[model samples]
Target: MRGDGARAWLDEGLKLLAEQGAPAVTLERLCERMGMSKGAFYHHFGSMPKFRTRLLAHFEAEYTTAIIDAVEGAGGLTARERLERVVAEAVKDTGPGLEIAMRAWAKQDPEAAAVQERVDATRIGYLRGLCEEAGHATPSRMATLLYLALIGGAHLMPPLPPAEMREMYGVLLPLLD
Candidate 1:
């Protein structure tokens, strides 16, 4: 269990992630931002890699839980509809820039990559369950394609009107049917 100070450090670290890209987040930067010395930094995390790993783990847990909850709350809804809702909520919740930062950090950090893999696996599993529930065939392939489309599309999506965000769901939702 982490004490208040440690949790504070983690909170500040995540805030930095939200404010700036991952590359710009450094131990020195955190120290300066938190108004702490090197000792305080090392007290919470032994090294930069360790801190980065924890940060990714923290983000993964929070994000995956949100996705799962969104899907689960769509009880009795069609799989496609549940998935579309998840995509929309995920985008609004995570914001475009933070999602990009996560992808960028995951690309460069093994620990972050591991968290990404776990999150992806969980998403794929959720889609598989949805397919099963809907009596759809080829759950694995469908899950893979669904995740790829949504995640990849979210990354590359250009600026859109608020209406377009919800409207895009209508366009893509049919593919799952």
Candidate 2:
């Protein structure tokens, strides 16, 4: 009976996804984690396909769109500041587990792959924009490096911490000067 709401289900799903990857996100496991049942899940999502669709959408909006919106909406910052904010906001978002899970899922699920692709493009595009604004001679290159460093950090055996990642960004960011 706990976690009856749709948001609850999606939130739980994201947690499961982050902890266990795509294959581990079965209704049984999800319900077990939520202390609920399949009926509650079906009541909210209607079908597995529908649920997956909604879940992917939710991840994109929460983990990607939200970060971009926040940074873009922040007023009066210089481009370098915006770039720094992008790193800070992304680190604050801290989706390493979910990021790895979604990427692994994307390898098998075309739907996930498409969403991942769009998400990547949008994230990188934002970085590139910020870099361009910062007057870098090679904005795209700088942007890609920044984006890749974050992605690479996520894949490390221990997974870099936010503090360390920010420190790393501090080092790389000066290249833009």
What candidate 1 gets wrong by more than 4 Å, as runs, is: 1-4, 69-85, 157-163
Q: Which one wins on TM-score?
A: 2
Q: Per-residue CA lDDT of candidate 2, range 1-177, in tens?
A: 367688888988899899989999888898888998788889999988899999999999988898888887998889998888889987764558999999999999999999999999999998999899899999999999999999999999898998889999999999999
Candidate whose lDDT is highest: 2
Question: Model 1, clash count?
Answer: 0
Name the regions of candidate 2 deviating beyond 4 angstroms.
93-95
> What is the TM-score of candidate 1?
0.74
Residue-by-residue lDDT tens digits, candidate 1, 1-177: 222476667767777786797877798888888888878889888998788877877777667776688667768877666776676665564455655677777898777777777888887898788766666677778777766755665566574433555576567556656
TM-score (all chains, Cα) for each model: 0.74, 0.94
Please give the CA lDDT of all the candidate structures. Answer: 0.71, 0.90
* Global CA lDDT computed for model 1: 0.71
Candidate 2, run of 10 with poorest lDDT = 86-95
